[model samples]
Target: MSEKPISKGKRSVVITGASRGIGRALAHLHAAHGFDVLAVARNFKDFPHHPNITCLPLDLTWSDAIPKIIGCLNATARPFERLINNAGIQVELDLTRDVGDETPALIDREIALNLTLPIHLSHAMVPLMARPGGTIVNVTSLTSRQPKSSAPVYSATKAGLASFTSALRHQLAPLGIRVVEAVPPLVDTDMTLGRGSGKLSAEAMAQAIYDGIAAQRRIIAPGLSRPVLLLNRLLPELVAKILAKS
Candidate 1:
């Protein structure tokens, strides 16, 4: 599908998972700031309708379609200043439970969306973003610091993405493209549902993300993520115990 024509001289940003929650907030924030936004997600029935925002509804779990998606992006006349890898899914499956016929498929989809899709998108987009001041933002989770007991696969995928972001930052530094890791604590999104207490609102988290990017912060850990990351470093055993009980 062709991207909506953007006005001349507007900076562009690509944000995945832009249909709701933090992603939606980010899309609105950037659009409000006069950035041409390419918002990608599976559903766009409720996506924002703005002159600066172009909604592309596509399921990110289809890994093979990534190249075509990137090609469509590259064909656009607008210059891409930022790529926010925000599309993710969490499957809370107990490893101890009996294996169901659908278990493997669910696990595969989780890994594809959370880890593989970002990697593929970044791999393709980095070359296009070789210009100075370009940035890649990966939205990981606090679960990366301490794996959750109920969501083992989801936690593992986040942890893997965290490692990839770290290595990518150093690799892309010489190219003048910054790789940023946004490790958010439990956000009050549909993904979390009824799980977290005192979770940061999506708008608040989106504002923090914008601020962090503007400041060029390599790691943006908002709310409880700040202290939790510190505790993970300083008191590994205590952090593990706490996570186990959580």
Candidate 2:
């Protein structure tokens, strides 16, 4: 479903996983900053309303998801200036565990949602993006640099996305479309609850992402992720060990 946008003159941003957490914060932040926001999520029944925010309730893993999104944008006839691929899922499981009954489905869902959907969505959205200065922001994780033992699949997906973001950046340069990797630290979102300490708020991360885009930063490693990435470079083993325990 799509909500009618309140205004048309403002620059537009399309954000996935926008019903809650960082995605929700991003939707509100961009709308507040005078951008018409297309907020995509599976459900928006609980999402806060905003005149500039148009809600698109969609299951990203569906085969027809990309087409539906394209249709929604086509209805607008306006190119989006930014696209943020932030929808993801993390299903923690031990690969060595004897839970075949659930392992395969869980792994497949995690991989599909965390990696495949974003890749496909980004490719599909490129044509709809504003040329000469469009930005595509892929939200990554610190776990990409140092895998979390309990969330192996999630970590792997983030790492794969990071690599894709870098390669896409070079490929899109001629088109004047910038691809960015936003590596946020452990955030105080539902996904990270009961998992980490000193978590950054979703609002803070949302602001940082906006600032990074404005500054044309290809890699935005905000909060603790900045120092952790530096430390990881100097002491990879140490960083890995620490993350393995998280």
In order, candidate lDDTs are 0.87, 0.88
Model 2 misplaced regions, further than 4 Å:
6-8
Residues 1-246 of candidate 2 have per-residue lDDT tens digits of 347853555699999999999999999999998888999989899887788899989898888988998888877746779999999888787888837887887888888888898899899988878889899999989888888887889999999999989999999999999999999988999998897688899999999999999999988989989999999999999988877666
Displacement of the residue 208 alpha carbon in candidate 1, Å: 0.8
Off by over 4 Å in 1: 1-3
Residue pairs that clash (backbone atoms under 3 angstroms), model 2: none
lDDT of 1 by residue, 1-20 (tens): 22576454668888989899
RMSD of every candidate to native, in Å, equals: 1.7, 1.5
Collision count of model 1 = 0
lDDT of 2: 0.88
Alpha-carbon deviation at 205 in model 1, angstroms: 0.7
